[model samples]
Target: MFSHIQKIHFVGIGGIGMSGIAEVLLTLGYKVSGSDAQKTTITRRLRRRGAKVYYGHQRENLKNPHVVVYSSAIAPSNPEIVEARRLDIPLVARAEMLAELMRLKYGIAIAGTHGKTTVTSLIANILTQGGLDPTFVVGGKVKSLRTNARLGKGDFLVAEADESDRSFMHLSPTIAVVTNIDPEHMEHYRDYDELKNIFKEFCLKIPFYGVAVLCVDHPAVAAIAASFPKRFLTYGIHTKADFMAHKIKLYPFKSSFELKINGKSAGQWRINLMGSHHIQNALAAIAVGNELGIPLSSIKKGLSQFKGIGRRLEPLYKNEHQKIYVIDDYGHHPVEIRETLNAIRQTWPQARLIVIFQPHRYTRTKALFSDFTKIFDGTNELFITQIYAAGEPPIHGVSAKKLADNIHSNSFNVHYRENLNDVVHDVRGLVKKNTIVVTFGAGDVNKVGKQLSKMMKEMPLQ
Candidate 1:
């Protein structure tokens, strides 16, 4: 259906999802041009790959394009958007184009509020290692793939089905993996049920012969499995699932577990990734791999070889003490933060848990501030950074300091770092050896972890 398009313009092209799509289009020999608020590594990479990228949104950016694809962050008032409408060019949202592309391939959409990136990367790793060489697009960089987007000649296409703005509804995949559903995206979704129904719609889009991989750990996702007409495979830590991970052992830098499919012996598996959430993520991949008829041995090989995706409990380094562990994760949501913090606790129960959290998007912060207040229950020490405003204008009442104060009052040791530099200084001074320092966010907070790693490397041994 996209054959007629010679040129495509994207607004908000710097976004991970948008950049992944642009990479695929560039591989297909299309002239790609786009605009973003600022230059980022993703946009720089796109430009190096021969894409025409503009620094800021402009009406002229929409000129000479057969189609204009914009992200949910871009509104109707955006200059390019106005131009697209005035010029009468075909306009499509990012998700719509992504869905159209998936329809042409054997789509496998990995979706959930918490583990979408990890699960998507897991499946991509399995497919690539199995020699399927499927075209895969993930939100974060997977060390297994070496990149977020890869164009393969194989028929299979793997993507992360996003539920924000109800975007997951657009994808119809042969295999759909719903990791877990939690109350997120309160902006578009009225409540939990509204979000659940959106996922239900996404599941119904699968063909009768297709399979739905449901995470039995979450009742919301498990409940939606019944809505699908075709066979559904349930996977989780619990034995009740069709695919279950039992006797899971989570080490500081690695995890090992046994997999069982429908109460039958599958095999013992090991991955370099840490945490039980990752163990569950592996199960999701195994479910899809089995459905695609990949051998158990191949799946095992793939899972074993997978180092992990970047920014998902990705360990930077550790000193001889083995006491200091520096990790980064793209966990902007409260649910994700809770899980990551718990995972850290599991690996380092005796170590002091130090978390540097950067809240992304003003809307998300405003909508879920109360939820954020409760996320640090298990964390020993919390450092809140300045809000990472993706695009939304600051809501009048929301601020990082306010969230920090709430956490402090709610029985947690919390403090707000209004400035990143100040936060870095304080963290470096206060963080002692044997502290499990986790930097969590979807924004520039990742740089804090990197800076800490550099400083730690430069510091002399005590």
Candidate 2:
């Protein structure tokens, strides 16, 4: 694919996933250029790495590149995309470019509705510790690495395969990991059964020699295991599987578990992430390590050294004397929110839970309205922000105010804040001592938690 291509341009370069891929391509000696609606920390970093980044997509930003790649978030009518089409430059989807990159290396693509970022980072860390020097492209920044993508000397290229648009079908990975499957991306599928078949098709994309590591604990994932006879491996906690965790122990901000492969005790493993969801995420990585024949000791050490992704329940600040704890997570889905809340409760059962949530896309808010209303009972205080329209036209009755009102009507204490420009002001009175302030959303709602943390850090102790 790179036979005559020297430069590549991206349409939505500042996106979390697109930035990672752009970085990898930059490191591989390609002249990279991209344009986004706004300049972000990602764009600045890419600029530092010799990428030509332009703000506000214009036809003029489409420099004469051999090929152009665009983010899924970008609309088809984007000026750069239209310009590329008129200029006769080959235009590619972001996943198509990712697939081309994977074609050049031994790919390990992690796919699922959730946990793909953490799982990809864990596998990369383990492989690195095992002396593979593997390349990785994660959707979120890894705390330890301080970056989301790297081009390594080894042959393996581990990446997070996105399923939001069913773009994950573009790659043929040597080891495919499906953490779990749920009814998500309903915009892409007609029904749940169709989504299941799409995932199964993704698993079947692997060659005869490749393996699909699935989480059978999810009935949808297990339902598709029959698609690949001997080509599938299983990993789970509640059910007996090929790779499983047992005797799990979770502490504040950390967790450990006994590892069992093929029903035989491999060893006890520990990771620097909390919650059963994290434990399940670790199991997926462990299964990958075991499949690669990486020594168990290396796997254990890698997991222990893992500091986790930036927003997968990342703690922004902690002050025991002031009893102020704040965390931010990229959990917009109901299952993710439930698991994160469960993890928080398991770690700090006594702390008063305060959640600030912002709905992401209008489509998702409307599709999962019932589930969203049901998950807020456990929180002592809840602050709901207006929906962030991520380039989507608003659905008629799918405002965040409606969701908040519905939850309030359910006899829960919910406060709706329409403006988040001053998120701290919107909920300052609610931040009492001995409370764990957590932000749940994929949008800028995390700013609330960040602001709260800053306020707590600067405030004098009583």
Candidate 3:
């Protein structure tokens, strides 16, 4: 804690990562203020906790702040950032601030291209259930805790290390977990080799006495494990690892599998979360729990009781009378969409699976165009909307319609809707007695599922 720096302001404070850190700072009795382009529940919650919240950015928002923290989403040319620089005040990246917070505690940082949020939440929940009330700052809201961040009295500090901006490298944690590695955040690295190298470096940052948990199923991660020269634990289903899950059984909303430690059966475990991906996440938590001397019983209870994080296959609305269920997920990448849709298909094999997918970034859509075309095969009907720019200038040749056309060429039931309202309206008409609707993406496409769920609730049973 910086005694001299009393006030800390955040730019783009509404971001999940930014908000969590802000909440932690508030709990530490610091004067926290922040600005975002829009007011959200997270921002309002911070305001109620005595942090000054601003709806829009302005030079005046930076008044008398000892330091300013900005997320990767915020541009350097923003008014508040310019004002901070003009005033000669210290400026920090969001990851820099998070690194400082972890520096003081026995840190456990989770990093990967995907499943970081779920893995971090699982570890946090396991640690919490074991009676070590740890300080946690995750990217998504853990439904069990109802908040993304908490300052605890225990010695552990758990957080998700974001690699999208290559900022996760700044963190040096006592225990580090890398779920998997893929070709993502291409904007940050020169190539796939660079991305892999950075992860190797990140794991090596662990002290001699520390440990690194890795997933061996992903080839890239497996490669990193081969190169890592330190204490490490490996977990996966397809690959032989230190921690492994086998004999998996998948249900509509849950899965059970046998857990093995070092090729010996530890126990049978079940998780409410779906997909093989989630099972791998739980395995990471188990490795961490065992390493920290927590009983397997506590880890089992923690995994079983985890309600799941928001927007990671979160059930938005369920209508028993109408026999309709709606799920919202933040899966914009091709691999994520493929796995998520596969889980939905396995869960409800009889229901008509209708998907409303909004492509996340122009760059991502452009880079993974072919993969998107092939990933939606599990859906009965697929609706595509315009790409969510996510602050990037539109790429000239990339558009949602083109993606739809490419998918259509493969004889898939895909449609392009230029308007979200029209897509929602059409979805309302398309609902049948046995239907499961899911809105998929990293952007505002979730609004379509929410509105449709509301409309379904108001409809009477036939």
Task: Please tell me which predicted candidate would have the highest lDDT against the true structure.
Answer: 3
- Show the lowest summed lDDT stretch of 10 residues, model 1: 406-415
| lDDT of predicted model 2 | 0.88
lDDT of 2 by residue, 308-385 (tens): 888888989887776768899999999999999998988888888888899999999989999999887678878888
> For all candidates, what are the clash counts?
1, 0, 0
TM-score per candidate: 0.96, 0.97, 0.98
TM-score of 1: 0.96
Residue 423, candidate 1: C-alpha displacement in angstroms = 0.8
**Model 1 lDDT per residue over 365-432, tens place:** 98899999887876777899889987678999899888888885444478788787877778788778
What TM-score should be assigned to candidate 3? Answer: 0.98
Task: Give the higher-lDDT candidate: 2 or 3.
Answer: 3
Candidate 3 per-residue lDDT over residues 74-127, each given as its tens digit: 988999999999999999999999999998899999999899999999999999
The Cα error of candidate 2 at residue 448, in Å, is 1.0
**Candidates ranked, most accurate by lDDT first:** 3, 2, 1
Pick by TM-score: 2 or 3, better one: 3
